[model samples]
Target chain A: MSDGVEVSVVLPAYNEADTIEETVRVTLETLDSFLPAGAYEVIVAEDGCADRTPEIAARLAREDDRVRHVHSDERLGRGGALEYAFERARGETLVYFDTDLATDMRHLEELVESIRTDGYDVATGSRWLPENRADRPAKRGIPSFGYNTLVRTVLRSDLRDHQCGFKAFDRTALESLLPAVGDEHWFWDTEVLVKAQRRGYRVKEFPVDWTPKGDSKVDIVRDVFGMGSQILRTFWELSVSPRITRRVSLGAGTALVVVALLLMTQYLDPQAVLTRMAGADPGIVLASALVYAVSWPLRGARYRDILSSMGYREHWGFLTGAVFISQTGNLVFPARAGDAVRAYVVKARRSIPYPTGFASLAVERVFDLLTITLLAGVVMVALAATGSADQLLVALTDGAVGATRPPAGGPLSPSPPASASPPSLQ
Target chain B: MTAIVASARTDRNFVRRTVGALSDDSYADYVAGVVERFVGDVQTVAADASAFGRVGGASLLIWSLDVVTAIVVFAAFGVDVTLAVVAVGFFAVSVGNLAKVLPLTPGGVGLYEGAFTLIMAALTPVGVATALSIAIVDHAVKNVVTIAGGVASMAWLNVSLTKAVEESQSAGDVEVEADD
Candidate 1:
């Protein structure tokens, strides 16, 4: 595709003295099988090697014109070295790999062919694909699986392996994508691929046999954390910081309130309810309020007992206050959001784990339901035995029928004059 | 050494039995496995024997107060109700209380009122307006007390309602993590 060279294979090496010569020899042989002598060249980026790697690479460069070495006096990371080599590449297509040749050499041809024949702007090798074969211990494999899953979730990308280290790129495509890829370290591969996808470029993935070779230079924990942060940064830049998120949240909240109001108006009669409330007896209201107030302390005592049984011995007053706060939250919010508040109170004030608090809350609910159901069951059986069940059903159905009747005053006539009510049933 | 070999043999037999059962099409084995796990978790949080009376007594007291509140409100409305009628109304109130736990609305607002009023009209010869009036009064008294109590508790504990709600939402997230 270019005047003299069809492909440039860049091997980014750093302190790879042990495997540099063999890697170079195998690469040269691999390229020679498919290309003419001058059609392809191998560039070994000796990235500030403090060992015999630079000397070996330099010697190889001198022995054959096809083998060239680019040296940096200071440490350029894997991405930095690739960036340096890519700038000097003369081929129409560029390929890069780790110095250890972790990927099978057979797939190298397939990667390059994908760009030349399949018309993909970039071809990446995947070790995690279902058809791919990778030989690595669980110690390494587990983290790799986890990291890739995080990448897929956070960046919302479909690439199977972003850190495979064996990728081929169309020269023009790489140059166009390079301006947006700012990472100089391990995250460069992910940034470039994500950006490429966002820009609607076609990327092809090929299954490859990958075997771990030599000791790895990667600090797994550090790199995982660094990549996680980078993923978040990219997500913020590409998605969240925009005005669309705020607009959608605002719109959804408004819709919920409007729908809730509409439902409330449909189901409830505001005028009748207000009228009844106005006529309510103050003395009876005060009595009901006192009974309700008494129940709060009882509820608190129950909560304290449950927590104490669970080995979280909190003061009775504190537990009662916690229940009050949680109940308040329930009253204020919908869907029992206050239950979570209760759990938080337990965790914050008593140092109990949230789950344990939640479990206790669940137990309390079970008891409450059990008690209320038992009472209701006993009363229903009593009513049935006394033959009052039939009368009650008749009255209930009559009242329901009366409610739907057309006339303003039917069997369920508007409240009969309070002073002229029928004689007491007693 | 003999005990160790015996225990290992027992464990192997158990695994073999489990595999054989699961290989069959019958779902009884799966049901048993689920039941066993559930029972094991329940066992971990079982309350101490000593606290049983306190919890039981508190539950009874709370339910009794709910019934009393219903009775008092009905009387206050000048409704001619007998003792038996009062008992029947309490049953209806209990059912309504249980329905409130469903969270159909804030504090089961419309749901509780509908259920309670329907039961009142059915059990007594009261007009729909009277039943509706009774239902509203009953709920208002409870809710007014609840709001007042909540505000007072917030002040007593020095916790803001907003912070409580936020903490509650986050606690739900923590529960999900714990479950995982």
Candidate 2:
């Protein structure tokens, strides 16, 4: 073993005949600046080449025992090659870099510092320091640029760039992350970051410096489309996977409370509401039933559309049944317990991440809330316009006597407890 | 030979069905084809009858934006407006949702209005009084509104009221097809 190595720098190489030897020489010579005082090993994953790439890498390995070479008969792309090399490597802190050397050894030092000392679970490099993406070529860069923007807008992730590949992680972090890596292709980077975020592990994105390497084997256009689809899917998931749906479920349960109140309104002469239900017109009862019955399916359809957009062609009927069963559990129990049931059903049925499937439920609710608010807004406007504004104003001030408040009390608590009944109403 | 026969049959019919499903003009026909399959099925019939069970389950499980709607509508009355009339009016609709949910009681029978009425019953009297007057008139308006809203939604969707009703009816049933 070359100079008794301690760090393993696993580099996955495709048909980079022009840059192969230099990449190997540079990595071996610059090893002093990259690794600690102990021994460092370089692993080149040789796949995807008709050239003498494997031959050159082997000669380097033969000359310097510190350099280890792996020749894969079949090309596994960047992800598979790394998977193979990392599987074989003995490095305590496993790191993989692009052969282009676009990002220098100095950034590796920073990554090493973050991993070794900075109390972070994963230290990744980001190129998202600037919006230089627009300067990039269209077919390759446009989709990726548009994709990251979509994820940030929809998922609202602070990660500037999830698509960049020049990342280094603690050996332990990589080991832990690798098992859950769903995609064996370019989407590997996006998946790893998402899993880290969802699992509540600390993932730090540090901007790195780089020059784009030669005619990149990276079909950037194709991968960006795929990664975008993946990120959106995960965005739908983790956003709703947590207790939000259940909270929403709990919130939906309150619709019953609302219904009860509406029915009560008919009876506020309580005597009359009952007589109306019993007598000539059970009209209110029928209307209320229609609302309750319609809520679930409308919700199911929303999720169906969302899933289809994300590349899962789910049957609405199957989704509706799953939603129905899960919600029933949520309603029977309190505080959104129905979410676990929902997660289980989807995971069991479709084998999707519980959180991603759960997010669809939450997204659906966002729609529902928007719909209800818009309708409520119209109704409120109508009521206010009719000079019933004073009535609407008082109800907002009056807290539920015993009705439990929203756990987050989000929009409901926007106005601090002033109790100032719209002074104009006065 | 058997595999070859199976392959041939799939190639013969599958291609036609795929084209039929994908053609933009055929989507309506494709969806109609599915609906027709369930028309005579017992489980589908049973499902329509027990649609409440599915809808009931959904409210507790779904946790959608509607929750915010109920809260916002209810909150509007007291939170800022502080008018007894508005508070009661918003509440009537929320409870109207709740009472409707009651019948689907594991997903059973009750109304949002009924459930809401109960919540209001527990509230202070003045608000309850306002809530009552609003409930009486709101439904007449709400029905017009619900119908208008439904019609508008159907129109926006480029579907018929018949389809909307079918969707509404089918929406209540949990399993139109078996889960894979």
Candidate 3:
């Protein structure tokens, strides 16, 4: 059992009374061939546990000296626990894995070997990425889709799997990135990779066999959401730091501000415009307001639908906020700058890409238009039969679609006969 | 799932019926086509169309409210019945088409209402026309204000419209673009 320390196995466990022992047994059994029998110590940083997870872990520690266990009464969560384990690991290349064995032992060995002998700075399990970790349930896969998206956009981290827990890091890369990752919970995966990536570290992913940890404590909503924000925070921090070489531009924001200022001028005389507005009919005002307030949720829903269809899952609150913000931007910024803003926010918060985000938006608009067109044709014709066609026609013709129609009689309407308008070569 | 089911109830009756009236079967067929085409183009087919990280839920609401808003305002302003039909119908179709041109109005705030009023006013009675106009202008003002707020928030959030629109577009390659 004589061997030099090549791979250090760091297991960050919180409360794994049900499956941890199995995870260690499998790893030890499988890893004995690859590395020396006593070369590796399974450094288990047992985070504050309320159950027998710590006690059981301690018992195992006594059975094999290689099974080292450290108890930190203060719960540093997933990220902090791993940080501790990595710091105390005995191997030259530190590898931290999920205690539930989501990543199978064979893949774990592969991961360690990929970095130990090879020159890779970090190796992670990618479920949907090029080197996919493993097959995942729709629930797990769906959230990863969203998490990866947010990571790509907000942090500009190119890695496809943002939340994969089974990963190995070179001691140099780990030491460099570990300090920057503050999230004590889930997002720590991205924090480290993004930081590592930004620092010119070579990170690679491999598809590995993994099982969805059945008794896993991952609160998808709370933990995922919290990680999303932290991902953005890390991205921002990385992007702004002179120490990091990778960053992206916040595009056209200044020009957007300039145009927004111009649009604000229109509402300045809301009272004054009343006469002009009411002259045309106050009905339009009320209708317009209804459209504005109500569209928020609808637009949000549209986004939700597209993402769901795309297999990306997120909370409705985040989506609605995205729609509200984006639509609101389009309204004020005359040049359609709101779309950019909306995409940026969502990308920042959700870790999805801008291109993918806006694609859904285009679809929502088309559907919306088709719906509007249908109403106009049928309802207007009905009004025409009732002799109210003129008013409805006026509304439709005046560019109710959010553009200025040919002014009252300037060219298109009532000023001259249709034949005389000369088709205007529009 | 419930929210999705609830929102997916896009009130096809209105869309279907509206499309159904063009020229008997012609109208119905046309409506059906419009529905198909519209549904086809929407982000429903795309995988990543959302505001931030959530999905889009505003289509039905936006469409329904457009109709309801028009009907209510026209009624409230004491618009003549005859004029209401044309203005309401006219704005309805035009609003959707307008979205096509811009490819990115966010939520069609000021432009939608303003254009709706201008287009509808020319074809209706003074009373009805005036009411519809006011409805549109008010919506525009609010929309403009909302856009302003969104811009402010974008600044706070440090995002851009291009990023939002492009990301959404990336969710599905509908090939739809901003014409205006």
Candidate 4:
């Protein structure tokens, strides 16, 4: 807002000696149509011009107080030159467009006002919008369509036209965006627009009347290869690399393991398993799955109790999810690597130490093993007291020596020892 | 060194043949141009003894850090950190790293753990579970450290890691083209 200037329109001029003066004059006239005198300034950002562009810009700046010449010693590329000029601009709203005046000047007020008064952080004119009337050659339109589609698909951009030269930005928004923008050339504004959207900035895109300039600036090889690579680079930064975080990797790893287990199920005849379930009393099958499902919450509650003893209290639901993820991890990984995953999850999510988590897991495993052993011992003693141990041994020996048979309950439960025993033993 | 040169020469022809089979005449010519550039680069590097020495020394140092990290992780898990144990750890790390170079999985996730566990179980008195635990912990530590460093450098430079890498690669391409 220096010198009470409300808007700064920068024309990034490289070798535009012919159009520099006229562009500045038309820009001033357009600004004057809507803005008060002394409220706007025109900057001829002369980027290392070897022609009469600098001289013309300097003379214009000298003649009119509203026009100023910001010169660079070397080529800063298109984005670089604009960024250089923008840093030195004194207004709250900054605007730029191609000096070719290809876009109609009638839309300048809307473009400026979109940011200045409409509260949009960024505003850009799109030729591809249905309302816009533009006469673009097939050569330019094809490449533009492909490039914009690539940006939208890979970078997840919402804009229809990214490389449009007519764009305006609120000074504060541009300042916040410039630091994260890596491109300093044709891709600069596109990167800014994409990043501004990501940062939740309010951007407005409106259709504008346009005409193709005399010759196109799109070099197929350079623009395609360079900008295509930039799109992938941004994709990697925004999408791929962020997923490399430990928490994300943990989730992804668990998901991959689950997918792998599902794929492994392809080895089984799913129809046969389903047929067995259908034949086996549907109520029993459903009850069995429900029984197995009930064990998970019990496990979670047990883990919560163990953690509580260790002075790390946590909710059973969260603990249940953690346990589920770790068990999923175990299905694929070897040597019970899932134990470590559980340790990591508890430590990361609940602030519990790894050693404490591992200790609790060890205690749980010991209790499980002991319970199974005690139950087996009790069964053996009961069989001996009933004088059926001899019958049981004979039945086991006969079964081992004969053809195997599926359990009576089918795949719903393990082989039924009671059914396998001799009638006397049973 | 001779083995590597022979391998590179074989790979150059292999690449040329593959591209030639897949592409037409103009693309074949482009492939030949790229192969010549590759040959020139290989010759330049092969001619520089000091460069080779520096790279080799740096690689050895990095691998040593990997082994030391494994040893620390094992010690944390209550493994006896004896001289013999350290030697076994070094062998396991080397084998694990070599196995992962095959690119069988992303970031060599499964391969590294498998090789490290196999080596540790075969050479030391550690059981399979203990060996696997040590391997998993070692790999996690190294990966976490690497990810943290990458994130820090990205923040420091105010650029994405991929963007920086792509820029450098493009710059290298430009330099090679200039030389051509």
Output the number of the TM-score-best candidate: 1
Best by lDDT: 1
Per-residue lDDT of candidate 2, residues B47-122 (tens digit) = 3333423432343444333333333333323333344434443544544553443323322223443444434433
TM for candidate 2 is 0.41
For candidate 1, give the lDDT of residue A49: 81
Better of 1 and 4 by lDDT: 1
**CAPRI class assigned to model 4:** incorrect
**DockQ for each of the predicted structures, in order?**
0.22, 0.06, 0.14, 0.02
Better model by TM-score, 1 or 2? 1
DockQ, candidate 4, comes to 0.02
List per-model TM-scores for chain B: 0.73, 0.35, 0.37, 0.66
Query: Distance from true position, residue A142, model 3, in Å?
Result: 2.1
The DockQ-based CAPRI class assigned to model 2 is incorrect
Candidate 4: residue A39 Cα off by (Å): 0.8
What is the i-RMS of every prediction?
A: 10.9, 17.1, 16.0, 23.0
Q: How do all the candidates rank in terms of lDDT, highest first?
A: 1, 4, 3, 2
The residue-level lDDT of candidate 4 at A393 comes to 60
Report the poorest 10 consecutive residues by lDDT, candidate 1 chain A: A404-413
B33-149 per-residue lDDT for model 4 (tens digits):
555554534433334454434333333443455566676555444455666566566667766766654423445676677677655654455544456556766675555443443
lDDT of 2 at A40: 74
DockQ of 3: 0.14
